[model samples]
Target: MKANQKATILLIYTGGTIGMIKDADTGALKAFNFKKLIKGIPELKLLDCNIETVSFEKPIDSSNMQISDWQKTAEIIEKNYTNFDGFVVLHGSDTMSYSASALSFMFENLNKPIVFTGSQLPIGDLRTDAKENLITAIQIASLQEKGKPVIQEVSLYFEYKLYRGNRTTKISAEHFNAFTSPNFPELVESGVHLNVNNEVLLKENVSKKLKVNTNFDDNVFILKLFPGINKTILHTLLHTPNLKGVVLETYGSGNAPMENWFIDEIESAIKRGIHIINVTQCSGGTVLMGAYETSTRLKEIGLISGKNITTEAAITKLMYLLGQNVANSVFKTIFETSLRGEMND
Candidate 1:
């Protein structure tokens, strides 16, 4: 990222709708051969940066995205960290938020742009939005100022907006604007010009080397509470073998049913060394643990408050923290803390 030096961008394609095209023989959708990617989109030659392409040996639908895939993605970035100026990750939109959030936690002290983007329609379709999304994502990743990358954290760009990857949630299935960052503001927006909200971006850190942590423990579950959530269901989830963490999707303001059994069950789980984090079911608000009488018991019984964190981020953060084997005494404090700008202060 030196002045007058052209940026080099690594495009990591991990499979998604954006990489699909209709097979000539059967007309069925299939992954586009990335080796021919440039041939298909010669427009890439027009960019000011040098672009290199890499693909997952076997591309997977985002619904099938797993912990191992996340590790692989992180490893890819780790392997090329020194050689590349920026990275653009092509991921399926279905579980893009989870993968993005996981990568944000996996890489500590990240100092380059890792822009994740995918299209709602296949690139072959005449009405596809894939071209614009891919084009703008690379543009954002290539942005530089004072001989340094402008974006230094993981982010998601869809439709026309760029958001902190961990702060995003897929909000629509049919529309082009499929993701939203409810609690945090967008980092960049695309239109007639690419407008970067510089103040909202994560400040760059140059002193520390990029550290990749792939030890994600999947011994966690999200227990979304609802009316008539019986004791049997609660017991089953709480007593699951090797259950290290639980992202409890509680009622408004992190409230739960004010019954003796509910309190006893939650307290028992906490005593058994189970980490339960209370996140609001609502999409756009912080969890106020002691704002109501019903939530007062949870706050007193040692549940961590996930202030305004999306469920996708909460679950992945739980896995990342658990895998770190953080001390039991400090688990609550650490869970509540804003790591990688996933939550507000």
Candidate 2:
């Protein structure tokens, strides 16, 4: 890399509020053509990077996103990984955390930045956060340290803060600040200057070749625990056909009822080869199993501890590992471990 060499960035628009505009006569929001992206954001021309854009022909809202969509996004990145210096994914904020987490697992040994961003208001709105988000996300992607990509992992940029993708969750619907990584500090922050906490940024793995994994098993479900959950209802979910994994969103610090029936239900499921992961319901804090009597049974029954992992990451990780056909003996250990900077130590 040379000073005069311009970095090439690939901008992928998968459709969301960021790609919508109000029709003048009809006044209804519709997808904007990516061909007019440069014209719409004239300031992009001033940037040092050469930009190329691709889009989904039928822009599906974030709510409609599926595993196939995640596969498609990964495919695009895989196909163009060599050509682009960095990548930016324009996605709807509603499910951005899930998408980002999924991609983090899909792209193994990623050495380039994949910044995911979207807006609460449409890009054409009078008051929009789209431009700022888009601009900074690209800048973060194009960042180079000693001629190498600075941020070398999947990340989400929203409301002037950049967070590790798998660590973030959408916490609001109406606010510009819609995403937060409650359990993790931000990788970067934008204010008077783009303040990057470089020490925490994921270091690039230059030795490993980039691998795109799209074989995700969706035979997993989230069972969020609540007070007074019926035994019958719990049994029914635990017996869902073809269920290979479960993200059990447990109470504080991964504690759950110490009742014999509850512990037996989980033990039965685990014995039947169903992976039971205990994740804390709270936004922050690690799951310290056996820290209390309520959680000791879960540990004794061999439930995997999702320590400080977001539910989005836990579920996606379950699917990824299951798709890989990990052995049952090692599944619990792998699920509890951080595969892609998705969880803390």
Candidate 3:
């Protein structure tokens, strides 16, 4: 890694406040040409990297982000993976976490940075935080250690902090500091000097070639449990046509009512080959099934524990695993285990 060498970074604009500008007459925010972005922020030219920009023909808002978009994004990465040292994804703040999480699982044996970032206010706004986020994201992606990419996994960078992508959630709408990885620690912190927590970063396996999985089965749904939830509603949802999996957002420690009807519905669903995963509704914590009598039946009934996994990650993991056609016999075991460093053991 010669100091004179420059990392070649690819900036993929997928539509977000970071790439938005105010319409002169309409006064509404609209997507701008990412190719001309570096001109507005000349600071990007000063970075120790060679940057190239690409944009979605019709950039979509992150809220409108779907499986198809994930597949396209992955395809772009796969096609250009060899030519670029790292990738910076510009996505809307709203659903950035979900996209990031999905991409993490999509790229198997990834050995380069896939950094997602966005701003709360439009980049053209006077008070915007877009420039800092965008600049830092690129810098983080282009980082190298001993001539190799340092951040070799999907991640989200906002407010000067770099987080494991799947672990982040949009915690604020108006504030510049919008995303938070509640259950995970910051991978890097940017202050006067960029700080990389090398110990916590994902270890790269350079020996394996990158493999992309774009087959995402959308035959999944999330069921957030609540007090006095009617069995009829639960039954209806669990019986959704072609339903393959469900991310059950349960109470503390994955507990639920011990009523016979509730337990019966769960068992019935499981028996029918519908995967049920128990994830905590709390912002931060692991699901400790069977810790209480209320949760004992859930564990006994074979609900997979989503230990410290965010809802975004849980739902996407369910979709990814189902898409992979994991054997029904080993699905439970695999679901409980952390894939792509997405959850705690």
Candidate 4:
């Protein structure tokens, strides 16, 4: 691969709806060969970008995606970092947000575009949108202006919109546009023309080098606070054996009951060195933990506010940081900061 070539794009097929095909005889979903992608979509020739694909030995749904899968994606990028101008990840919708969010954090100081795209329908079917999505994703990946990458961060390009991966969430199950990022603004809106929200996009460190950290420790749990919950239940959750982190979904603005049992359990978790991340249950607003009296007790403890970070981003960031074996103190401080443009910094 020549560095001076117009552009080189790497397509990483991690398995998902885009690769699904219904057998003519049995009508069952099966992974189809991506080699036929260009054959089916002849329009790819207009892209004018050098593209190559790498797929898993046996494609699995995103629900089956594991730490090993993330490790594989990171390895691909690492091996071809200098050879490719950008990357596009084909993933299933079920866990697309989670995986994209995790990659946003795992890849630090990224200079090239890492755009994740997949279709709601299979590529082989008639009236399928896979060709358009995949083709446009490649265009977005190789897009440039003034000899600099147009997008220099990890993002999700779906249904003509590009969003910061960590800020995005899968909000729709039946529509082609299945993702939403209400807290942060969309980076690119593809309508009559590709409209990019340049201010919201992240800038790369021209001097710093690319860094990839594939280690992801998923030893975490989520506890949603609801009314009529018993004290024993709260204790059981906070005292879970071998707990490393927790994503605590609280009421509006991260407010939670100041009841003695609730406060005690959270405090105990903090004392035990468990990283407790407080995020608002509402999809739009941030977690202002100390903004209300009801949440003062939680702030009195060491529970950290996730701010405008989405639940998907929170869990993935926790997994990535924990896997890095970072110091407890550093993890506590960095969790609230935007490391890879995953949160509003």
Candidate 5:
């Protein structure tokens, strides 16, 4: 990239509230034609960048987003990797965190920005926040130093903050601030001027070429523990046919019941080669297995600690790792280590 070259950005509209417009005929909400986006938001013409648009043939709501949708998004980025400087993914906010986390894992050695954003209100609304969010996300993606992109990893830009994709979780539905990064700080903040926290940004790996990994296994389940959970439920879930992994949502610091039946069921599952990950139910803390007496048995029985990882990241990472056909013996070690900064060391 030369200093004199203008940035080229790709806007991918995958059905969401942000892309909806009220139909004059039926007064119903419909997906906006992204090809005419500039006409709808003329402010885009003022930016010093070349913008291109693409849309899903049939837009899907975020709640209905599936693994195939993730693969399609990855394929889109891979297809245009060399042609575009950055990508702004307009997705529904309901499952944006999940999609963001999945994309973060799917791309390897990425050196360009893949920013996900959406709004609570439609862009056609007079008092909508969609305009600001959309414009700022593109601006953030267009930012560069020297001749390279400033953001070099998958991120989520919402309201007025930019957070690492895997670190974010949706915290609000009614408010404009719809996302939060519980275990990590934001990478950038929007205000009078865009303030980037360069210290937290992922350094670009220019030595490696970008690679996309679309393999994802959906044979994993999240087992959330609660008081009075009985043996039958535990046994039945663990005994599910062809189950590959389990994300055990334990109590604070990864603590679980110490009952004999509970220990027996968990130990039997592990012995049968089920990979169980211990993560805290708390939103803001790390899972410290063996930190207390209640968790010592779990550690001894070979539960992998999900250290400060959001549940969204944990499940997606599990699917990614499982799809890679990681060896059973080394799976625990690899999962405990951070492959894409999804968890603390």
Candidate 6:
């Protein structure tokens, strides 16, 4: 690598469909050495970038993903904070949103690309989509103009679409287009030409230094309001011992039942200093806590609106923000506000 060379990209493979291969001995799927990745994709040599791989010591299935794994990914990024211009995470699609959302909140004031990508099929298959997904992700991570990153936010690149990581949710199991941003537009779409919707991107904090937050409070719960829900179960969840925060899934426009017991329970939780975030159950709308009389009680009881955020984003954002030991009064304000380009301003 010369002093005046192209941008460097760090490809972090944290276990996913993209790295799987047929083990000759066992005939079982296993993750292969990333050193052989280029041999399978010769087109990578045509790109004007220096790409490097950093695979996990022990590849984990998406089902085995843990909070500790998130910490490991963060530490890696922190260690290479200045060496690489951007990062591409080849991850299991099952938990990609959670990982992406966590990273979005963890890396405050970040100005580099962190694109997460995975395929529906294993790379060893003849018709595997992994090669296209991985190749383009590398290209996107290395994208720059005027000597600055064109994509300065965490994103998910899959099935020819690039979405804001924190704002997306997986909505399919068998389809190549598995994820979507319920309320936001696609950030970038891959085609004959890569068209970037710059207007939808999060503006980088040009004045603030990059701040990485490692601490995360995992003492959080989610309760989706539905008809016929038992009040006992509801109280148990809200009244859990030493609960810190909650992500409440409410009806359209943040409407909840006006039942006296429900209202009273919410009020009591607020009195106990538990942050209650009211997010809509619907995929594509913002929660308006006071829009209707039905939701007035929620607002009066101090429920916060999670405007246009997916369930995956809400839970992780709450964990990230709550871990910072911020005051209770601040949690409501911060949860509803757009952080890490997760929601609209």
TM-score of each: 0.99, 0.98, 0.98, 0.95, 0.98, 0.96
Clashing pairs in 6: none
**Models ranked on lDDT:** 5, 1, 2, 3, 6, 4
Candidate 4 lDDT at 219 equals 81
Please write out the lDDT profile of model 2 over residues 1-345, one tens digit for every residue: 565678889999998999999898988999988999999999889888999999987889999999999999999999999998899999999999999999999989999999999999989889999999999999889988677888899999999999999999999998999999989899999999889998888875699898888999999999999999988999999999999999999999999988889888899999999998999999888899999999988998899999999999999999999998999988888877788888887
Candidate 3: misplaced stretches above 4 Å? 1-3
Mind giving the per-residue lDDT tens digits that candidate 3 earns over 1-345? 454589999999988778899998999988887778778898998899999988888999888999999998998889889999999999999999999999999999999999999898888899989999999999999999888898999999999999999998888897888999998899999999899999888986789888999889999999899898999999999999999999999998889989999999999999999999999999988899979999999988899999999999999999999999999999999988888888987
- Evaluate model 4: give its lDDT: 0.85
List model 1 lDDT by residue over 67-97, tens digit each: 9999999999999999999999999999999
**Model 1 clashing-pair count:** 0
lDDT-best of 1 and 3? 1
Residues 244-311 of candidate 6 have per-residue lDDT tens digits of 88999999989988989999888998899888888888978988877899998898878888888888
Q: Which stretches of candidate 4 lie over 4 Å from their true place?
A: 1-4
lDDT of 3: 0.92
- Model 2 pairs whose backbones collide: none
**Which residue pairs overlap in candidate 5's backbone?**
none
Instruction: Report the number of clashing residue pairs per model.
Output: 0, 0, 0, 0, 0, 0
RMSD of 1: 0.8
Candidate 6 global TM-score: 0.96
